[model samples]
Target: MGVLESILRKDGRKFMKRKDSDAGEPGRALEELRGSLYSDFHTSDGAKRQQQRLCGPFVAMTFNFIVAVGIIMANKVVMGMVGFNFPIALSLIHYLTSWFLMAIFKALSLLPASPPSKTTPFSSIFLLGAVMALATGLANVSLQHNSVGFYQMAKIAVTPTIVLAEFMLFSKKVSIQKVITLAVVSIGVAVATVTDLEFNVFGACVALAWIVPSAINKILWSNLQQTGNWTALALMWKTSPITIFFFMSLMPLLDPPGVLSFNWNSNNLFAIVISALFGFLLQWSGALALGATSATSHVVLGQFKTCVIMLGGYIFFNSDPGIVSLSGAVVALCGMSFYTYLNLLGSKESATTSNKLLSKQNSFSQKPKTAEDDVKVEVNTLSSV
Candidate 1:
């Protein structure tokens, strides 16, 4: 009986040990499964967040670059090759098409709703739209009168023009480095204009006429976005109608009578329609870039576009902008690039200064208030009283 009782106790102990081991296996498997799931979720979430962070600026820049270059080439073909001599009319078509597209985007919930009228005043929007019309109109006129290379070279003047305008109008101060760079840019543009075989007085005057309005337009666009938190599409939607009105009013005055009699054949229609579509994309992408970046960055992108467009003109359009003109463009580009760098550096310095001030204030607030501080405050209050 003693031996049997000992045997039963030993078997019971063995059975209990086996049961404990079996229970642990399931828990171990469950923990492993949970760890695997957590790792996968962490990896996927990190990748998605990274993509979202990068997508905006990358897409904006790429969109601006491709459409900007393509639109210029397409417009050159339409205006120069297809003999679409009415610059104002062409601009009108572009604005109208853009407005229609914006409407569709609004309906589809792709674009944000227009801001409240009180927040974005009609007068300001109207002014921007009018200036936009004048800027685009003069651009087309300049393109119509000038070779593609010369037109693009003239656009480089806008950077310096913007700098001067800001200083004069808003008391904005630029660094000496930026001033020197802008001077270089101006000299380079003058050299290119002088050397350009295709340069005519009217074309040059029109190109020169374009610079101020263009500068103002860009400044206003940048200001509106940064200060008012305006999205590009929303701003465009509000301003397009004003632009259209300006275009319509200018059409009769500027566009010649032959528009009605001009042949609207399939080829011509197709070319013009395509050019107009590119025009809409140009406005959208340009606004996207300006909003995503800054006026300075936009100008830098424009400088890059200038280089590509000039090269494209030489290659595709058989433009013989002599070695001197090309050299001038190179000088201007180098100057513009330097100016952009200086601006960026200055911005970073300012940002750092502001951050330091904020940190100091935060640190002071976090510290426990001492009796001396309270005494000083009380003293000041009594003194004021």
Candidate 2:
């Protein structure tokens, strides 16, 4: 009987051990699944951050292209078909609309927080806005006085002008490779767009005059956003009033008389308002692109936009731009693509160089200071002074 009881107890102990082991198997499986899920979540989050960084410039350029093309087409309909001949007045309306939108966005908390307005002086914002307005007004005047081909030529010249202006104003040096690529882009655009060659002293003067302000405007827009940490909406909000003031100041000089006599049909009003909305978008998107990329890149993007517009016109409007023009457009596209690739490569190299510099600095900082090193530092500081 004693042996039987001991055997039963041993079997019971074995049964209990087997049951505990069976329960732990499912527990271990669940823990493994949980760990894997957590790891995947973190990996996905990292991937998303990297994707956003990679897509930042791409998204900005895409927005700029779509809005810019839409605005140009819409303005044609409003000004030519709808007969809203007052370009300056239209510009004023655009400024007002943009300002209104900014206010709404601010109220809705849609725009990201930017540095305080006080950080960027009122004068600087005012100057930027004034230049922006002047650039617009001068462009209109140039277009009015010059042939379309001459106007496009002047527009193409803006790339080099901006490069030269940056070098002169900021001591920024562009690579020779980039310069050559830009030259090709300009020639291609010229070949593609310039058909009629008309020259008037007044037109030539206006076109030349238009270049400086345009360059300054682009540079300031880029600098303020990139360096000042200004959000595009915030900057646009601050500048819109100054822009509106300039448009009002210039309307008398630039806009033809009898604006009030134009037929005020609902269709015309709607078209103009739509164009104004697009104009606001154009301002925002241009600022975004400028902020994301350099001023020169923005100008190149504008040239790309021009090619796309011409092709689109040919496709949608059934207007023939000739095989030569199409070929030029193809060439321009290729040049622009090459320019983008070079820029990306340059950026990677610069980043690597900067990282190396930062590592050297850190290592030097981490090193124990010696009397000799301290003496050398003091001597260098005194020499700098």
Candidate 3:
């Protein structure tokens, strides 16, 4: 998966070239779509700003968590009439549709967007994009079998997961504060994971499938974004095509077509179409955030997402979080906060500087001026004097 991430970076140059060329007209539609979603669904105004700032990722994850519950409930109702499970079908359908839409968008980009230098090739990016899609798709699949709150707990687990990834892969040393934080987050996972006892065995197993890629993708996508290798949306959008291809290949072998073919009612259809758009937004925003920061920090901060969703679940369903869940959440949140604070403090810039050493280097690079300019200025000054 890491190698695949490394390979996808090569395609970023090509993707960026396409993005620049299409900035004028044909590209306007997707930009418009992204802008509309950001404004209407993402950005919060007025008093909500602080709420938005405090738990940035939480708002989005809550939206996703709610949608997951909605989809499951909707699927149950719809399946009653259609006599088939849509969730199973959706595991493949969502990717299939999203990728196809992206491919068409890519085609349209060719019409108006200018092409970039030929140095970047398609194969390089295709592999990385494929890795991204696989990671994202399996993560989504985890939600199908797991309850929102349970899945959310697993989501919180991604923090320590990434920390471990960094430690093992990058040889980073852990501090005492960091170790304590990890312990707190681990406790939260225990509370959240233990409660869904009826079917948790399966839910947890599926969630682990997601956790590995989620952590890897977080770290990989972060670096890819830092180096300007790929714009955030393009990485996820491009992979949709490859994801579709892979899903399509595997679905028939695993699930039946009769499972997908359904009685299309207006309401259920609306639900799915809406979910698809949200899915895109979720992936894009997530990629944007990861690309903007260190993956380790990004994952650690993302713990808030699970907290919000768990709280929201309690409100919506009147589901009791109980003592264990509450304690776990607090501990996990504190750990993440402590870890983030230490990292930020350590990275702070110092005021002291020695610019005198730079003076010679600056003087050596200067442009030459005529000596007469000195005489001219001197004569002018004498006349003024």
Indicate the residue-level lDDT of 222 in model 3: 69
* Whole-model lDDT per candidate: 0.77, 0.86, 0.60
Q: Estimate each model's TM-score.
A: 0.73, 0.78, 0.61
Task: Sort the candidates on TM-score, descending order.
Answer: 2, 1, 3
Candidate 2 has an lDDT of: 0.86
lDDT of 1 by residue, 80-181 (tens): 799988989998988898999988986775665444577767788988999999899888788778886577666767877777777786677777776678
Alpha carbon lDDT at 348, candidate 3: 50
Tell me the deviation in Å of residue 306 in model 3. 1.9
Tens digit of lDDT per residue, candidate 2, span 1-385? 9999999999999999999899989999999987765443234333223323544788989998999889988999997999887878888888899999888877875544556566778888989999999998888878878898999999998998899899998899988899899999999999998988797998899899989999999999998877775767767877888899999999998788988888889999999999999999999888888878889999999989989888988999998999989888889989999999999998899999999999999988896989999999999999999
- Model number with the top TM-score: 2
* Candidate 3, superposed: residue stretches over 4 Å from native: 1-84, 87-124, 146-157, 167-176, 198-205, 253-257, 313-319, 350-385
- List ranges where model 1 is wrong by over 4 Å: 1-62, 146-157, 192-194, 197-208, 292-300, 311-320, 367-385
The count of backbone overlaps in candidate 3 is 4
